[model samples]
Target: MHLGKKKAFIFIAIACVCAGVFFALKTSNNTVKISYDPNDGSSKTTTKTVYSKQGQTVQDLLKNNGYSVDKDLYYYSTSLADQASKIHNVRIVKKANGVITIGDKKIRYSSVQKTISDLLDEKNIKINKDDIVTPGTSTLLTSKIKNINVVRVTKAQVASSEDIPYQTEVVADSNVTQGSSKVEQSGQNGQKTVVSEAVYHNGVLVSEKVKSTSVKTEPVKMKVSLNPSDIAANTSSRGSTSSISSVDSSNASSTSSSQASTSTDSAGKSTAATIGDNTSKSKGVAEIKDDSKSATVKDTTQKSETSTKAPDSSNTSNNQAASSASESSNNASMTETSKKSDENSNTSEKSDSSTITKTSTVNIPFKTCNVYVSNLAKGTTQITTQGVNGEKTVTTEMTYKDGNLVSQKEISSTITKQPVTQVVAVGTKEEQTTTQSTDSNQSGTTATSASTSSSSASAPSSSSGNTQSSLSQYVSQTKNVTYNHKTENISASDFDFLCAVVSQEDNSGYEGALAVISCIMNRADSGKWGGSTAVSVVKAEGQFSAYGDGNYTKYLNGKSSAAVQAAVKDCVYGGVRNHSYYSFQAKAKTTKSVKIGGNYYQ
Candidate 1:
């Protein structure tokens, strides 16, 4: 047993020596040379010598070495880990979760995404082209990055409408009374449609703009008639004759005579002395006759001896004159003889006399005069004083012979009411010019006010506000004016030209139309190819292709389409997209260029 023990001790000694040699070789083979890069902010690198057995991972190795490493930083090379002769290169870094700030919200995330864009897409966060972003989406994520910011932006189109007031027209009528007016037609309000674009950031409105306006209905003009009554009253105050004859007559005559015949006794001898007595009575009468045509006188006599004879025509005139003197005596003798001769016959003589006279009267009228007033405006007339009429009376005497008028003579003259002249005022002042101002608000509405001052030549200092007062006093004198809802800075002609150019250039669709207009505006702003104004830019020689083809002038005469007009308005008001493309060609393809409709822009 001692011999076996001594042999066992020697063998044990050899076994112990072999075991020490194997352990030394295994320990040497397990040794690993590691170089770690923290990749934090510090530039210092770490080197470590670790002993690891086969089938051990990099994470296990680091943990065994008492080194804490983030999961994101554990990496190892397969060739270095598998080959005992090669140096092992391992790296460890500090990493953090991505912090995203979108508007007012914050989100923490840990993802394997390579870029900010990939991270946002993975989180389903959307962004618009106009939205603002910090650390752009394509930027690579690193340990230095702690936060990402996104500003949400939204664009929209808003449409609204406003009322367009109608105007009144006044017409003058001479027959109508002053201070009175009659409405011929009632006025009606018109309608206009407005389109606007609104921009919002984080649910709050930031900016708004008008895109276009369209007239939906036309206004009906109000018509009124005015007249003055003074002219009619003055015409009616101005002024305009009727005669009779009669006759009456009475007459009476008487005559008596006595005679003795002694002629026969004287011739017979002295026997005639024997006394013989005789008695006779005679009477004569005259009568006058008057008629409308002629006058005549007649005589009749009675005697004791009577003889029947016809009167001669030559003695008629003399007899008529002589009969006028003894007219009464003859009439009385004839009456007594007729009564004595024919008491039972019932006959009697008649006498007559006639006289006639005539008279007359006359009338007159009124007048008007004019007075001028220099303070009043032209086409104005006023009556200061009214007119009155006058009258005159005239009398005349007329005589008639043989029942016919023969002579006339003035007897008296009289004055009635006297005439008064009319007074009128006519205006003779020059026309005055007025200035107007318009203001606009955020609601896209406008208000206008006006002020006026008359010229120095005809108006006094007191009449400085006449034009403004007249506008208020006579509201019916207002005229219609065209207004642009989008932009007031551009003139009507320039706006119209832009619309025409856009319509002619791109009538296929609205997008292309807007693109064409943007090009024109870009040229205007560039100040190289054309003038600054929109009109000057469009009409510049050999600029727009449409103008060179003679299509621009033809389209300008007509109305533009609604889409084209809206595009023009938006561009003018800065509602369209901005571009540096100043030229376009048809069917051309090139890099860094965009194609819209049928044209290529660069």
Candidate 2:
């Protein structure tokens, strides 16, 4: 059987401590020595041997020695048992209280900011000014906070408000009242945010995140104004009244002349209007008989004088004068009608002026413009540009008409790069041995070439191929193995062989090693009566090493005896997995109990 360096060099480290041996001897088993003298300038010493029983630390040792462990002092040590692994010298400080601090990493909320930065600050630790804060501003006060360090930090802080645009909403306000609200869009009341990103004081964000929001705009109340034109039209039509007066002054004028006749006329025309004054009595012939009766006139004159005193018979001339008086009154009424026509004309003109003013409106040009851009990143895939290398600023971009920008943009660039991949040439050793090919840079073919590979680390590759196919089959099959198939009865040795092959120190390009492990660990627990080896390792409820704190890499690397290596080899060559791909249960435990299929001699 071929042995690979007898247990992988069985790495065990030793630390020599001669002084430690002496110190331990003095205080190994707790030892005591002390002296005190009240007398003037005199001293005494005494010694006693003791063994440490309860606590194993040096502080405990000092306290037992009657040397008060200083509360401010720190102590550190690496137990001999941890020598194989890296042994850290623990930090310790005696506290005023009974508890002592190891590294004194414990922090309180009041004394610290509950973040890595505040924790360091509380202890008076000064970091670079450019250092980034971690755990975020809102990290909880807990012992879980961890500080990641960097030499110097180049901070790029960006504070932005995503317009919380006044939470605009269109409400169908048939009857909107002031200070009232209609849930048009329910406005969600937009918010402006203060976003801060922190990097490691020296490194990138190792952990923690926080988010918060505040309302930027108060919701607008629903409201409306009465339509002015509707009110005005209604008022005018509902309240205005029209009137006309037809006064025929001629009727009153005729009434004066016909008053006496019409009152007692045989035809009874008293209520009817007169065209002219009608004769109330006929003219008497007193003038013609005046001379003949001269002798009798003396006696008759006395009689005639008495008759003339009675009443004048003809009344036409007096009536005509009365008609003239009525005409004068009619003329006064016509003057008043002319004044009213002038007043109405003025009122109509004023109303037309008012209506025209209310309807006039002019458009004000829109101050804002929009830019419809295509071929931009769809989501927040941080578009970064080198404006001033280390420090960058963000500015708002405003789109205006005529292709002009109202505001300048902050980082208006994008770059795209291809994905990364690695490659390997399979069956090359045989090709080199038989075909003798020239180097990639050479033109002529060479003599017989040997199959040799360099041990130096290869450079990171810059090539892209089909994601899985080209690289998977080339995986080195010569290395050791370490895995458990789910169920189908694969032996322990076969599994280890597969693990060994995939983990070859020399590269054979198996990009799917981790993927295979994932599949095996997550497979169904069907045929093999249980689950995969990966699941079985964690079958202890929650203590499975894969999911536990144990490091599988360390376990695999650590001290293995020669016998174990031999046993591992025995199963790989002729055991459960001869040369075929197999599937198994996902929960099958007992990896040591597994065997190769159809190949075990036992």
Candidate 3:
């Protein structure tokens, strides 16, 4: 029993010693090192050592050591063990509130990430290689950063096909009728494929560039055949199908045929059918030929009968009488010949003289219209639309008798083309001038204001040389100046509205803003689109978006920039000029165009 009690006492002593060692280790203090880095741009860092119990957790250690952690701030440690000794270093970082814009989404987030790359990763935002990020990925994020922008960029090649219109060509053909035309060849349109590189910003197309264009088929030109007479009329009014020389030639041919037929029957029969072909051919040629032939036959027959029945000396008187009759017949034949010759000449002359219908063109003068403009300087004029002379067709009947003009009467007159009116812009703006001169070469006036009369005082003829020298000196000393005019029709409110429209449409620089103002001014001046005045044009239905949606009010009342205001003054006061452009749009519809800012003008 004594030996068992001694062993038990030794075991109890060992247990108490082990228990004391374990409690002492658990209660012992440890030094934990902590380092904090503020992700701010200052790059500041601080280190601290804290006393902690071995069994205490990281949170318990910090709390026991009087360290406070903000809820918005995220804390981290190199080691996250429950035991204080395991955590040698602890870091505390600050988070920031930021708004991120990517694609079409705007997200508000609070994160402890120090860089843009880390923030995007934390938000699970995927980025492609071709995408663009503003405030680059390496940019540090801080509390001061309020917004971030990311552009989703994509590249692609697109192919499209279009048909090219065929051209029509006209050709003169003699085989066709005098006033007729026919199609010689059919026209065919060509096809071409265009390859373009399209660029998109956030799924919206920003630009497209043509990479290549290949022809799939060639175009064919249409050919048309027109008669010479039709071509002559179409080409010019002076040209004629049947000229005066041709008319004269036809008349001469008919006259020669008439003379030949009166002498013999050889040419008469051959040409009798073609006589009607000449418009001036007479019927006297055939009639005279018949009479001459019959008379000749009768005379020959009578002479033969007399020769066969010869009389004796008692019929000598009959012989004398026969001789006298023969002489009478000869004289009669001579008279007939002379008369025929005269008739032939007269008939030829009558054939040459015929009524001709001619058509000629006359010019009709165009009217001039003066449009008063306030923007241009006084006494200045600009031609907007050129004057064009119109044409009219006058049909006249000319009667010619004995190769002489008898009379000409107009049959009809019709206008072929309408005259284009001349449009001139006249300046009405008054200018301040120092003096007015009579010299035609001088333009504008001096900048200074004066009350000198335009006409100089009459000089004495005795001192003409001195007066001329003095006048030359006076002209040399004067300065020339120009003033811009204003439209008396446009009200103050309308002018402000016009400037506001320009500002809202374009944010580009001076020239870019000027392009917009010019387009509006051109539309107002043209008077073909909707209205003739500036305000009327703006208020026209379905024309401008700025006025329709009332967005132009944003830039009203001097809220626009200096560039926009200057552009307005330049356009309204004639400081800048635009003559061709009358229309503009966001997208270009024609190949030939001018691009300014984000709009296209043509």
Single out the weakest 10-residue window by summed lDDT for candidate 3: 270-279
TM-score, model 1 to reference = 0.28
Name the 10 consecutive residues with the lowest summed lDDT in model 1. Answer: 265-274
Better of 1 and 3 by TM-score: 3
Residue range 125-220, candidate 2, lDDT tens digits: 566555434434334423233343324454434343432322222223435332222233211223365454534333333222334555565544
Model 1 per-residue lDDT at 596:
69
RMSD of each: 43.8, 43.4, 30.1
Which parts of model 3 have CA positions greater than 4 angstroms off? 1-29, 53-57, 60-72, 78-86, 96-100, 105-115, 118-125, 140-148, 163-190, 217-602
Give the TM-score comparing model 2 with the true structure, all chains together: 0.14
> Which is the leading candidate under lDDT?
3
Top candidate, metric TM-score: 3
Better of 2 and 3 by TM-score: 3
Better of 2 and 3 by lDDT: 3
What residue pairs are clashing in model 3?
374-485, 374-486, 375-485
Ranking by lDDT: 3, 1, 2
Query: Is 1 or 2 the stronger prediction by TM-score?
Result: 1
| Candidate 3: C-alpha lDDT | 0.54
TM-score of candidate 3 versus the correct structure, residues matched by position: 0.31
After superposition, which runs of candidate 1 have C-alpha atoms over 4 Å from their true positions? 1-66, 70-87, 101-106, 124-132, 151-154, 165-189, 202-204, 219-602
